[model samples]
Target: MTGSVPVHLEVDRGAVLDGDLVLPPEPRGVVAFAHGSGSSRHSPRNRAVARVLQEAGLGTLLFDLLTEDEERTDAVTAELRFDVPFLAGRLVAAVDRLGARPDTAGAPLGLFGASTGAAAALTAAAERPDAVRAVVSRGGRPDLAGQALGRVRPPVLLIVGGLDTEVLRLNEQAADALSAPCTLRVVPGAGHLFEEPGTLAEAATSARDFFLSTVPGPIGT
Candidate 1:
């Protein structure tokens, strides 16, 4: 009842991306998660959201954006967090692999991103329009995606914590720069991580609705 389907993706840059592929017993669509800076596929909050999506019949992909050595090296300086393009490229390749799978072939593809991961996710969406359907950012930094924001064509949902004021301003700014259809939802009294009880649930609910509305259709009829 609780398990994962593992997968490996080779990036164009020669690095391998490791991930967990979890499919619903009968899936409606597929969601590829982009973990925030300093976080990985094992993030409890994202894993919590993944569990929610799984129960809702959506497939999930959770991966580490950095290698163990890179993580150790960057952990001291937090330098890798700004590698948006690098992470985005890896996501594109991962999507290509998952989107081609028999189980995911016919399902709409969505991106669920957190924190700095949101920046990379949006950047990837801009680059791979043909593959990404919908995008959701949770307490995320979509603004960091930079000019790539102008190229994102998929519907985007930015979920922010009401208590996280500065980020809200940034999300608002990024939302405006995005020509793609987008919405911003703020969770009152919640901080950047949405650790408040029921806050993450609320974020997950908003994300689910966005994916259901923006993604294409049911898997292969």
Candidate 2:
């Protein structure tokens, strides 16, 4: 695998988000991460999954959804983190930015989202039907996407912790609303955070396999 580098993405003209971009040699596809509420690109769990994908020859982009100032405000008011539409717009912009980059332009695009970020990923996939090839949500709140769930065209994988009952039910509801192919898998003994022994590794492996199968490319090319 090639070295990963820090990147500053301008999702809007003046709005920048911090990210880390990792490209493997002859990567087959790229997966962009949408972290949950109160999380950033630095999330250790997402980072761990990103490492697995990179080793498998899939490029990964882990970016913050909110600007530094916005995060601070949301910390106090707890409002903007749940704004699905707003977060979706940012995700779409990030996808566009990835497509525009020479190193990643030819690779198929996928999204991996966690928590409320899963809703944003679903909404963005619905918005850009042709751009996103696949989506995977880890312990996510996909039901928060509302009507947008029906519009998504890419195959989706919803990974829920077996112990996270409420979220599992929500994922099932969201799956029923989807028009595209969708699957829900539960990691036994895992909680919302997948903190149980070996559960997170299992989740990451599932995500890697799903993207590899759904994205049209020669793996490790």
lDDT leader: 2
Q: How many pairs of residues collide in model 2?
A: 0
lDDT of 2 by residue, 1-221 (tens): 77778888897648999999998768889999999999999999999999988888889999999999999999999898999999999999999999888888868999999999999999999999988999999999999999999899999999999999999999999999999899999999999999999999999999999998987584423
Structure candidate 1, residue pairs in collision:
none
lDDT of 2 at 146: 98
How close is each model in CA RMSD to the real structure? 1.6, 1.7
lDDT of 1 at 177: 98
How high is the CA lDDT of each candidate model? Answer: 0.87, 0.93
- Clashes by residue pair, model 2: none
Which residue runs of candidate 2 sit more than 4 Å off their true CA positions?
A: 218-221
- lDDT score for residue 110 of model 1: 94
Residue 109 lDDT, candidate 2, scale 0-100 = 92
Residue-by-residue lDDT tens digits, candidate 1, 48-115? 99888887778898988887777898999888878898878778888888877787776778999999
Distance from true location, Cα of 167 in model 1, Å = 0.4
